[model samples]
Target: MGIPKWMTGKILCKTGADLVNATDPELVKFIGEIYYGLFRGGKIRQCGLGGRRSKFTIFPHMVKKLNTGLHVMIIIFLCVAIFFSLVSFGFCILNAIKVPYRAINGPAGACLWNFLAGGFVVLAVTSFMAAVKLHQLTERIANFRENIFRFVILEERFEDCFWICVASATAHAVNLLLIAISGIHFPKIKTKTEEVNVTAEDIMY
Candidate 1:
């Protein structure tokens, strides 16, 4: 019934008069600070977005901590999704190249090559999808030239790299999963066990 906490928390002005009287620089600063705070505050919660109101009993710091965790999860998931997608893409592409289309002289070889090509196409799609999700997860707030943290980091080129890496990493996870399901196993380490060897000289005398 009341305005959402995220909405209220984002308020930089209490009155219309204040907004109208504010200078351009002042307004920009206020808006920037609010965005910066929101970024630091973590992912906005469902309660903050207009669900059952957050319990009044919870302390502000606790709420902030919870939000921070939520944000971190979002980031971590996006990174993972991207990583998997790219892996899938790479496997598909590499396999597809193993048998060139022009070199395929028989139906069986051609069929296998087609299958690999199909896998490559599927993985490319997965990678593209992961990129889309990553873009949404970051809320597209990150910009290449603009520094979101302002004074902390110098140009924020990392933001651009992060987005690129995430997109590139997306679908390879499926390739790994398929390999696992196919029963292909990686080498396992063997541990040495020490057992006492009994000799005739040690016959329980």
Candidate 2:
């Protein structure tokens, strides 16, 4: 450790032996650095209690452990929400079908099936959106590595896709229940050419 002549002091030891004999804190630190540079291949010195402790150790102030109970509660809530929403949606379709049919007087035909088909189509679209999000969440949970070819774009797309899935699932499920209870009728196309095929082949009354 060559100390500049202008900065000469007790801390700047002329030799290794002199550094070993020094008692000042700064001098000891300087001496430690010199030996560290020589023996540790130009790295910082390991000395006293300081050497034993890691520089990267986290303070208690920033630590945040995940709450297991909260996670479980959230999953349970999702299950219930999905269940009730689907049930209500089904009930709405039943009511809509039953509206036009008066026992044996009015035959359940295209009108009933059409409404059911529309409901399913809307639900299917929503499910597709949810599936997209679920796929994104799955990827994130499974893969964390970023590739050189797709470092920026893939990650960004993954985040967007994941959030969209969550939002769409929640929105569609809630919307389904709302539409079911609101006593609303969604109009369907009624084509005269699309007649009901009621062939009495098996029934023997």
Candidate 3:
């Protein structure tokens, strides 16, 4: 059968349409230049775009909408994790005390995990609470600044508390990661085989 001219024309037209939207390497290079320009000239900010902002805002909102049972389980897990972390920190301190006496022997990974993770959890939580308190104190002072006769207003205290909280939280997150990695080896059980010269005779006896 002879090929139709109309069909061939339609195929060529579709190929041309696809080429219109094809990516250009030259255009990509131009985009790279624009990005560098924005950075060097300070013409653009690193703020979240619409899609990025939506993703960033979605997780907490989704968590807030979780069912009561799931919420309760989350709370329970959080409480237990916090409690165990504190205990681990205590164990770390005990291990530290015994370190100088050379009384403790074995793989220090577990002790390290307990100490670091627990201590970080405690430090982060305490520092965050302290930051909250400092913020409240700052607000109270600001509200009563005119009414009070001799008030020493320290706004810097809140900043310091916030930084401390940030550092502690970062440390706590690292500790959690370390603990998770170390936990893989924590519950290991080793089996040993014993050899005897007269194993059959001993079994008969």
TM-score, every prediction: 0.26, 0.25, 0.26
TM-score ranking, best first: 1, 3, 2
**Which is the leading candidate under lDDT?**
1
Model 1 Cα RMSD, 1 decimal: 17.3
Ranking by lDDT: 1, 3, 2
Which pairs of residues collide in model 2?
A: none
Candidate 3 clashing pairs, residues 3+ apart or interchain? none
Clashes of 2: 0
Clashes of each: 15, 0, 0
lDDT tens digits by residue: candidate 1, 1-205: 0111221122222132253565755443333211222223222122111312122211243333233444444345444544544543554565566643442323333334334444444443444344335433122322212232211111111233333433433333343445456555668899999999998889964
Give me candidate 2's TM-score against the actual structure.
0.25
**Tens-digit per-residue lDDT, 65-120, candidate 2:** 22223323433444454554555455556666676455222223323333343344
Candidate 3, 1-205: lDDT as tens digits: 0111100000011222233443543222111100100001111111111111001111233233323243344334335545655665665566556663432322254445445554544554453344325433222222221242222222222234234435654765676576567547566688987975878778899
Choose 2 or 3, whichever is better by lDDT.
3
Worst 10 residues of 2 by lDDT: 34-43
